[model samples]
Target chain A: MKPIQVALIGLGTVGCGVYQTLHIHKQRLEIQLGAPVELTTVVIENPDKHMKIAEKTTISTDISDILYNPEIDVVFEAINGKEPAFTYLKQCIQAGKHVVTANKEMFAAHGRELKELAQKNEVQIGYDATTAGGIPIIQTISQLFRANQIQQVQAILNGTSNYILTQMRDHQLPFSTALKQAQKWGYAEADPTNDIEGYDAFYKLMILSDLIFDRQPDQKNIRHSGITGITDEAIEKAQQDGKRIKHIASIKYDETGNLTAEIEPIAVPKEHPLYAVEGVDNAIHLKADIVGDITLTGPGAGAFPTASAMVEDLCLILSKQSAPIPVS
Target chain B: MKPIQVALIGLGTVGCGVYQTLHIHKQRLEIQLGAPVELTTVVIENPDKHMKIAEKTTISTDISDILYNPEIDVVFEAINGKEPAFTYLKQCIQAGKHVVTANKEMFAAHGRELKELAQKNEVQIGYDATTAGGIPIIQTISQLFRANQIQQVQAILNGTSNYILTQMRDHQLPFSTALKQAQKWGYAEADPTNDIEGYDAFYKLMILSDLIFDRQPDQKNIRHSGITGITDEAIEKAQQDGKRIKHIASIKYDETGNLTAEIEPIAVPKEHPLYAVEGVDNAIHLKADIVGDITLTGPGAGAFPTASAMVEDLCLILSKQSAPIPVS
Candidate 1:
């Protein structure tokens, strides 16, 4: 009945959003979850720079400061890195603490092990923010697609690349200009290589693969390409041919039950579900046996949207709910 | 751990599909659910006249047969109409059995009492099939959008109407021909009044209203106009204006917090998410604060699609998980 004594692993954009949204919607959170989700501690490298905004939240330069605290019911891994997020999450699971994370990279590499560990500890590790930020696609897959054979998952899962390509096609702008515009609009990072080169989508694909396929996707087997070389001329030509150029990341299970994936630029017909999906938005279109096909689209990355997913996970943990264990 | 006992209340198109889908995907269901989900009894109006497809499931002629059997853990209410399906579900809930129904009409009319009754019994009553079939839009609202207030929900929720409108617009066919084509494609019922008149969508709106708004939306207050009035000339004019006619059902919560709903044709721009959504395809676009705006697309209605939603509910029940109890 008490508030979830929580620790945040970073003080970055999403961490700031998590802190801000939780503060802004404090009363609503208490009513919705039947408990207050308090961010008791935040681990940051530069406490001096972020202290003005995160004054109320207890800032720490040490991980052990929060990890050793018995009052922390959950830890949110908001930091965008691999080694420490993975290590901290493992420790949390071992300590029987529930975890809610926005770290797609960490989940992409080690989700199956993390899921198993969470089960062993009888806790939950929810990564809704990892796929489509705040879209609830994770819960949709776990809850709604539970009874169907999820044959294929295809998505435009990266927002930055999408913004570039959509602007090129719709506004007749070049990719570089679009990228700069996205950065100006706060949709792209200062160094947008991960998004432009399809690495962000690759990370998302790995996370979904873990949730759906129940195994880490073999990195060597996945066919990968980026939108770096996709030019304005190509976009114009595709548009002239009545086609839309989209960065599509798709994983398909063959009749033999073998999973194969591709992340590349493709010409989608005008009527495809992913065709209408434009701008800095993410869309996932799935083909399941029972449901025929369902597509979910939303902001794949943002401060509040990403934070919203983590907060949703905190609610799930308090509800003591876990996704239906994946079949295969 | 015994299997959850089930009593299917109807064996019509969706009922038959549910039974068949359960049997066909029994292994997948077991693997996904970490156990098997058995269909113990099926309620049929007439075993002699109705085909015997599900050989293992027991067929019943009377409603009391299932209602009296306390061993049934859940009741699948697939039968429509006000008399049997509605009455039977009320009795089942009164008897403390969990329910997963595909009957949208019952939910639209009498769901307020039923939802409260289920909560009183500390059980779940899921009707994911009632809204978007396999598209998983219902769960998205109840779970994903719980923390955020939705500004508007605009959707192509009815596949029959969408198919008719799409054929009329794309092929330049007359209304009668397009209607015939929809029937031929199994998108429309023999009596297409429910779809063409927009009553089916109206009922779905009521269900969504309850799930999102936590109150039964008054159909009297809603502005209703179906695809029947969308003429070929209108479609031509829309195309000339670089737009397409789409039957959009929308409910908007205003700045003052008043809820208003409408079902009518909209001339959606080509750049819009709903523009490329064609044929029997259906899409729901949600405008919200946190996630900016998100859209989900798929078959809004089908034996398989609706059956898949039922299966998803079964997983939710079997797995013991719930969250984002919306109306926030």
Candidate 2:
């Protein structure tokens, strides 16, 4: 088997993670994949600063270097947010290349359009790293639970929010104190509004709802709330009642198959599986017709874990395995 | 695509579960697979007595009915023990037919040989139902975590054993008393020796070891212990120490890459992830280099959950997706 050419579209936290992983695990990957997964080019904003790790690979600011490179079988999009990242991915698909992305914002905004484009081009589009980081929730829903009707999806999606809530509950810290601690720990961004305001989890819930309900979630109608409203009094009250407050993102299908999606801070009892999940960890609990409730918990972020998901998608694409076909 | 034909080798607990699930979820599966999954024949020991749910399918006592049939695309083995189930699975592989099984015993005994045979014959062999019931641990290890070198696997493989331990720990019941309760609740078999003596966990650990280590486990030398020896005093002592006594099956690879496999009742601290996994639920925590630690918890056993795994395997096979290529 010939080598499978690959390229990365970012040199940020996740991009560097992917490059380091691919470089360190090159031999192991070659042996497992029966071919080399070569990192051919890396597109970054500043190529000069990132030239240390770009020894044998091309460091470019031009995304066209990847788009026009027919040998690059798969393009990994690790750049955050939409814009040129989304535009570059669209061109990559149009150029007949498989794509694996860690961009939740892009998928949340234009997932259906991108999916349709990939299908039209007969190329694969994998975004397992987009949701729950390393938990593989997307693959679980698409492949493992394909036979069952997924009636409900309850998840702790935003690790930063959960971490803040956990800190407040455990140390009796106020919301602002917990938020500052989370930022110090690098779990939260400098501007943590997206996580604190429920937008981050909202994107993930939309992606999950789209997969389970087989339609784009009505984002305007989603019942969204956040941890900004959670106070020390509410936390203490829930604790007194033998419950812990968690930022939960959930979707449910009623008897008539109507979908209701929400993201809010809820007090979960000790018996609930998500009650014990703490600190920068993500968990997804799905209730399907056949399997009842199953939960998956793991590190929701970091380069290697997210890289773990990206490489798995590459393997699936290399093996010619298609993504799980969704049902309405 | 044409309808994919399938056969079942037993109509016992898991077999009946598969039948009822397939009957009920036929349309959903068809839509998901883009092809109908048809149940062609059911081979059972006592066919005459099991005619209630055998309405639309052919019932036969002959094993050759499926093995010799050219149209049967896949064979589902739900039978117990290792005799004809093993032989029939071998024949099915030899006949170039895919085989999906819930038989852990057969796999533990002859999994490497069967896997090689399947690869040689260029047919798929799926046994997700054999380990951790509906949790999809096998698929997760093989597909999702293929990029990581798994350092350790800690799991509650035997649900009956775990349930008994939970009962003893929570209610202070004696071993025999808790065993009786487990049996009454249909969580344990009439002869619970296999579960109590650590044989059930041993088999599952062996399977997991093969997947992670890419080598067959040495079952005879494995440090095997069970919950039968867990005394009420010990459980109470552990509880006082803020720990829970759980029947844990674990495999670890050290710095020198030496493999250590064991199954025993260990007192896990409250902070440990598997400590919260209680009752008949099963949980597996994998410590890998890339992903850190990831845990999955779900129904470990039952007709429906086990059937959910079998059906997932069927869909994978029907889609012509080959099994994950094992690491050398």
Candidate 3:
């Protein structure tokens, strides 16, 4: 069988992680795909920084190097932002390359357009790593739960925020202390506003909402609040009530099909699945009409977990087992 | 597109559920598959008992009715036991019909033979409902976690056993009383020995073991114990220690590839995911080399949850997205 030529479009944390995962699991992937998955090229902003990591793969600073290459059957885009990543991915899709991405923010905003473009171009786009990392929630929702009407989703999606909240609850620390601890542990970025302000979870929530409901809510109508305002008193009160304060992202449809979505802190009782999802782990609890209730809990962030999700997508694409974009 | 002609080879609890699910979701399925999924025929042991439920579909007492019908593309086997279920499924696969089964007992004993037969005949076999109902564990392990080396799987596999244990702990009842309550609620069969003796969980565990490890352990080497030995004192002791007595089906591989599997009552602590899994809800916690720890929890039994899994298999087959038998 011909090898599946693959390219990497970034060399950041998740990008490097994907590179290492592909390298380590190359033979295993070959056996799974029944075709070798070769990482033929790597695109970095600065080729100088990724020399050792790039290894034998051709390194280029230009996205066009991969975008224009007919041999590159798949591109894994690990860039973080909207502007160039979106443009590069769009061009890659148009070039007939199947794309797998970890850009949650960009996907949340422009996933519909990208999916439509991919469909028109007769290529596949995978964003499993864009949501709850390693959870396989996207594939589960799209494939396994395709026939069921998913009525509600409650999740702890952002690892940084979840880690911070776990620290606060476990050690009885203040929010600032927990944030600092999370930062030191590499769970939080320098400017943690996106996570602490609930925007990170909100973006992921939007991605899931789009996949499950096939529509995004009006931005202004969606309610969201961060964990920045979760006071020490509130945490103490929750503890006293035998509950854990968690940053929960939730979406539910009413009896009349009206959608309500929000990202905020909730005092979760012990009976709830999300209450036990501690530390940096993520959990998604889905309530569907046929299947009743199902919950998936796993590592929500980090390099290997994200790479695991991306590789699973690659496997699906390679084996021609990937589900169509759940449009309904 | 021509409708995918399908057959159901049983009209028991699960068979009726599959019929109802396929009937109710026919249009939704058509929209998803881009083709109609028509239940053209059903083969039941007693047509007299199922005429009302059979509705518009053809019902037959003979298995050859479905096996010989070239128009039938997929066959869902919901029969219990090994004799006819295994023989009928073998002939169906020989007839070039894709087969999906909910028979854990038969699958545990002869799944490998059936999968090999399906592969040789160039057809697909889906057994998602053979194990945990509606949790999607089989698909998750086969597809998402294919690359990762699953080091261990700890699961609550039997709903009847779990339901009885929950009642015993919650109501402080003896094992026999709990067993009676489970039967009264239809969670356990009249001959509840299979469930209470851990054989049900053992069979399901073996199925998972085969899927994940590609080999089943020697039946004689397996260690299995029932929840029948649990006394009121044991439940009280567990409660005092802030633990729950859960029937855990566990399989693990050593570094040297030695496999150890067992089904027994375990005193699960508060931190364990299985501790939170209450009543008939089943949970599987997987430890893999790459993704670390992941847990899937959902309704493990009942008509809808079991049918939900079978229908998902149907959807996969209809869309040509069903995963190949994981043979690594």
Candidate 4:
């Protein structure tokens, strides 16, 4: 079997994590995929910062190095934002390379266009890390839940906001104090605008909405509110009522087929599955027609968890390259 | 595209559910699979018991009805126990037919042999409904968790047993009273010995052990116990300490590659994920090296939930018969 040549387009937290994971689990992945997956190129803005990786593989500052290389079969985009990453991925797909990415913001905005392009180009695109990390909700919905009609999905998507809310409820601390604590623990970014203002959760919700409902709602119609405005008194009252104020990203379809989606805080009762989900854990409670109610809870974010989703996607794509392996 | 011909054996609870679900969701499944799936035959013990289903397809008491029909691409076995099911499935595989089964007892005893036979004959076998009902743990472990090293698994595998335990703790009922209530609710069979004696959970656990550990433990070496021994006093004592005595089937691996497995009533603390799993709801908490701790919870039994898994497997098999579909 010929090796599947791969390239990396970033060296940030998630990028480094993916590199380390693929390096550590190379042998096992080869065995599962029935082919060798070799990382041939790494594209980064600053090659000096990753000298150790540079020694093992070619580190280039130009995306064209991978985009023009016909030998590269797959490209992983781990950079944040929607600009150059989108353009680079588009070129890669046009160049007949399968692409896997963790850019949630870019995926939320331009996923439909990219999917259509990939379909036309006859290549596959994977974005499992765009939604809840390590939960496999995308594959679960696309494959396992294909036989059921998914009614609703209530999810705790953003780990930074969830961490802040948990801190406030557990310690009775103010919002600012909780934010500072989350930042210190490396859960929140330095900017923290996207996470604390609910935009992060909104993007993930859009990704899931597109997959589950088969269409995306207009951006202006989605009602979203961040946890920054949540008061300490509100948390205390919910606690007194034996409830927890959780930042929930929810989407539901009514009997008439109208879709309703929102990102806001809800006081969840003790009986609800999302109530027990604390700290940085993310949980998705999905209601469907055939399977009834199902909830998947796991790490919402982090180096290994996010990379784990990406690697799983890569393995699935590679496994399809050969004869189908029965997984019964 | 040619329609995939399917056969169902046994019109019991799960078999009937699969038939109805496939009937109702035929159009939708056809759209997803990119091919029509036709129920061409059904093998039953007594056709008189299922006249309605018999009216729709060929109903025969003879196993060779499907085993000899080369047009029958897939066979589903939903009967209980190991004798006829194992023999029929082995013959189906040998005849170059893919097989799906929900016989946990049969799977536990002869899964390895059946898997080997299927592999030798180049046929796929699906047994997702054999364990955890609609949770899709088998697919999750085989596909999504392929990138990680799974450390341990703690699960509530039997819905009848868990339902009885929940009634015992919540209503302070004795074991026998709870067992009667479970029977009345259709959660337990008339002969509740298999469920109450923990053999049902034990069988499911062995199936999971085989998949995760790549081997099965000797039945004599497994430490097994039942919920029948638990008294009202034990439930009260655990409740006083903010704990619930859950029937937990657990498997773990040490650093030296040794395996420890047992099925017993455990007093789980409030912090444990299984502590909140009540009634017929089943939950599996898996700890893996890459993705960290993950939990999947849903209805452990019932016609539709179990049928949901079987149909999902059917769709997957049918989908694979054509070009590979990218699920990302």
Candidate 5:
């Protein structure tokens, strides 16, 4: 088989991760996929910084270099946020190139639209790395739970918020101090508002809802809150009540046509699955009609973990002899 | 799209479960797959026993009925043991029919051979229900962990032994009495030797090893033990040491090619993930080079849970517009 040529849209944490991971696991992936996945082009702002790993690969500042590259069959859109990443991905799909991305914010806002566009353009778009990283919850929701009606989805999604909440509850520290500690440990960004303000978890819930429930609730209409409002006193009170406060994002399917979706801090008993999940770990518990409650927990964020998901997507796309099961 | 035709080879617990789950989730699966999954035939010991659920479907005691039927595209081999179940499955595969099985003992012994035979016959074989049922751990190891070198695999594979151990440690019941309680709750068989003697866990560990570490250590060479030797006194002494005694099945890959595989009673600390898993629940922790330690917990065995896995295989095989990534 011909080598499966690939391109990277960013040279940041996740982009470098995808490149490094493909290097580290190149042999094993080739054996598993029966074809080589090659990094042929990388689009980055600072090409000089990545010259060491970008040897033998083309480095370009313009995104069109990747979109127009005749050999580049798949593109890894690791650019953060919506502006250029979304536009670049749209152009890549429109150009009939497969895309694998880790952009949750863009996916949450335009998942349905982009999915329709990918179908219309006769290409495939995979966002397994967009949600909780390395957990493979997206494939589980799409493939494993096919025969069951997923009645409820409860998860601890945002690792930064989880780390902060754990610090506050474990050491009795104030919210600001815990936030600083998380940032110091590199678990949170300098701004950290999106994660701490519940937007990150909300976006993940929207993507999960699209897969499991086949409906995405409007962002403005959903009741959303964050862990920043969780006071030390409230944490202590919950502890006194034999409960642990966790930043939980939940979606419940109602038989009466009321699909409720919320991302907020909730007090959970010790027996709850989310209670055992702590620090920068994420857990998703699905209350399916057949399998009861199944929980999967792992590192939700990290360069290698997220890149592991991306490489899996690339292999799945290349190894597939025909088109995949349509997600939309 | 034409309806996907399926047949069942047993009306036992898991067989009836596949039938009932297919009935309950029929419409949802049809919508999910964009085609109906019709139950074409049911081969059972007592055809009259399942008449209420087998309405409009062919019911027979002869296994050839399903294999010879050209309309049946897939077969569910839920029959236990190696004698007729294994023989019938081989015949089905020889007949060029896709097979999804829940028989672990057969799989552990002849999984590679059957997989080769399936590929030779141009059919697919899925055994997600064979190992750690309801957890969806098999797919996670095969698909999600494709990019990582899996280092270690530790799991609680035998739920009956865990249940008996919990009974012995928690209720202070002796081994025999705890075994009786497990039997009373339908958690254990009347003989109960396969689970209690560690053969069940040993088989599951073999299957997991085949997926994760890419090594199938011989059953005879691997160290194997059971929970029958675990006494209440030992459990108490371990509790005094702040540890919980669990029947653990593990595979460790060393740098010097010292691939250690064992199924025995071991003591786990409180912080260990397996320490929190109790009852009939099973947990698997995979320590990979990239993702570090990831754990999945869920029901290890049940009628519906195993059936849920089998139906998932059915849907995946039929729902795919092309063949799936072959599992070796």
Candidate 6:
């Protein structure tokens, strides 16, 4: 069989990994999948940007360069946050190209519309990497709980915040020092607003809500808080109290329409799943009415983890599986 | 759109939960999925058996009641052990019905042929519940690491054995007493050959091998040991050393092939991710080239968790998503 040609938007960290991953494991992936699933084009900010790649994967700088061409059946959007990510994604769906993204920001804000658009266009949109970067939290919740009532979802969704908190807990360093350490280790951003302010986790939670609950928080209703309030003293206090400070994002709903959701640093016992989860790791805990509680932990970010998530989505796109059957 | 029609092959614990789950979450599932996924056909040993909603569904004694019918798009097989369960699943796949099963024994023995058969039939065959009930380990590794190499898979896959060990650790009780208690709680089986003998965990490892590496082990090549060899003195010694006794299943591959693969009881330090996991819980720790180390935990068995896993497979089947470039 012929390979399924793919077009990627934005050759950033994750985009670069996608290219490298496909290139490195091309033969193995082909052997298992029964044929080659190729990356035909990579749409990046600049075609001459520093990237590790072989000569085979053709690169492009414009979305039109790939989108207008009829050869690309799927497009992976790694560009994140607001605007064009949403607009470009919609264009992909409208063009009947299956999409898989590691962009939590775009999905958290615009997932509902994207889902509707994909369904309308009979294409699939995947956000598995949006939360737990290659941990399959989205797939687990969406697939595993399809027959059950999802009551709650709680997660350690931000790797940068977790890395900082882990440093504070281990070294008894102040938040600023820990944050600096995280930056030094490349876990945090230079600006770090989205990650440190809990917006990153909130965005992850929002996308999870859309996928698992098929409903999302109202623009203003999500009760979000961040890890900025965490201090070295707090981490020490938590340890003294036999707990660990974990940045958790959670959403809960009852029989009524009342929804309570938040992303904040919570004091968890050492034995709690999230407490055992350390470093730049991510985890999702699902409390379903029927499925019970399920937790998934893994690398919440990085080039390989996030790009790997998109690749997983690519597999799903290849399968051409339909959406969940509505329980009516 | 009408709900996807479901047929249950076994009316045991999970079957009852699947029924109750579908019934209890009717409204929520409908709201989220935008359509109803219904349990229209149920295949069982006897229609007269006491089951939740036994009277409501089209409960029948033969597979023809669901498998031969064109309307039944999905078949959830919840039976354990071998024999009829394997044959029934084969019939379902051959008849072009998408299959979701929790029968680890059947899967361990037949997954390769089953995957090939499903593809030939142009359908899906998923066993998310087969290994860890609700932990979603298979899907976690299969879809999440779609872009990375699965360096290794380590799991405490059997909840029954874990519960027994945990009781011994916490209460300093004899293994026999803990085993009795676990049996009373229905965590372990009457024979206990599969779990105590490490067969269950071994089979689960096989499934993971299929998902992450697409490689199946020759039965003779798999090293299998059981929890039976773990003594009370060993447990006490480990606890004195701030360690714990845990059953582990592991598979690692290198350039030559499987570097190491085995299932056995082991001593784990208090700080290891597997150490803190206790009770009727299952945890799978994954080490991938991309995502790093991610550990997932949840109830290993129960009516709801397994059904939740099957439901997850249903969601995957519905979504019809495959890996971008298939790793397994």
TM-score of chain A by itself in each prediction: 0.94, 0.95, 0.96, 0.96, 0.94, 0.93
Which residue runs does candidate 2 get wrong by more than 4 Å?
A321-328, B53-56, B321-328
Indicate the residue-level lDDT of A5 in model 6: 80
lDDT of 3 by residue, B24-141 (tens): 9888988887789888888988778874754557888888889778988899999899979999999999998889999999999999999999878878889999989988888888
Candidate lDDT (C-alpha), each: 0.81, 0.87, 0.87, 0.88, 0.85, 0.78
What does candidate 4's lDDT look like per residue over A274-303, in tens digits?
A: 988888989899999998999999999998
Q: Model 4 misses residue A326 by how many Å?
A: 12
Give the DockQ (C-alpha) for candidate 6.
Answer: 0.41
Write down the TM-score for model 5. 0.94
Model 1 over residues A1-328: C-alpha lDDT tens digits?
Answer: 7776788888788888888888888888788877787878888877786735545568888888777888888888888878888998999888877888898888888887898998777777788988878777887777567777678888999988888898888789888898889899988889988889999999999888877877655677698999988989999999899899999999987677678889999998876778878787888888887777778888778898898888877776666442332221
lDDT of model 6 at position B257 = 63
Tens digits of per-residue lDDT, candidate 1, B182-294, equal 88878787999888888888888888877777775465768998888878899889999999999888998767767889998899997787887887878888887666688
Please list all clashing residue pairs in model 2, or write none if there are none.
Answer: none
TM for every model, in the order presented, reads 0.94, 0.95, 0.96, 0.97, 0.94, 0.86
Model 4 TM-score, 2 decimals: 0.97
lDDT accuracy of residue A299 in candidate 6: 80
Name the candidate that leads on lDDT.
4
Residue A147 error, candidate 5, Å: 1.9
Candidate 1: C-alpha RMSD after superposition = 3.5
- Checking candidate 1 for backbone clashes, the offending pairs are none
Which pairs of residues clash in candidate 5, taking residues 3 or more apart in a chain or in different chains? Answer: none
Write out the backbone clash pairs for model 3. Answer: none
4 or 5: which has the higher lDDT? Answer: 4
Identify the superior model by DockQ, candidate 4 or candidate 5. Answer: 4
Tell me candidate 1's TM-score on chain B.
Answer: 0.94
User: What is the C-alpha lDDT profile of model 6 across A43-117, one tens digit per residue?
Assistant: 777777757655667777667766687777888888867768888889988887888888888787788899899
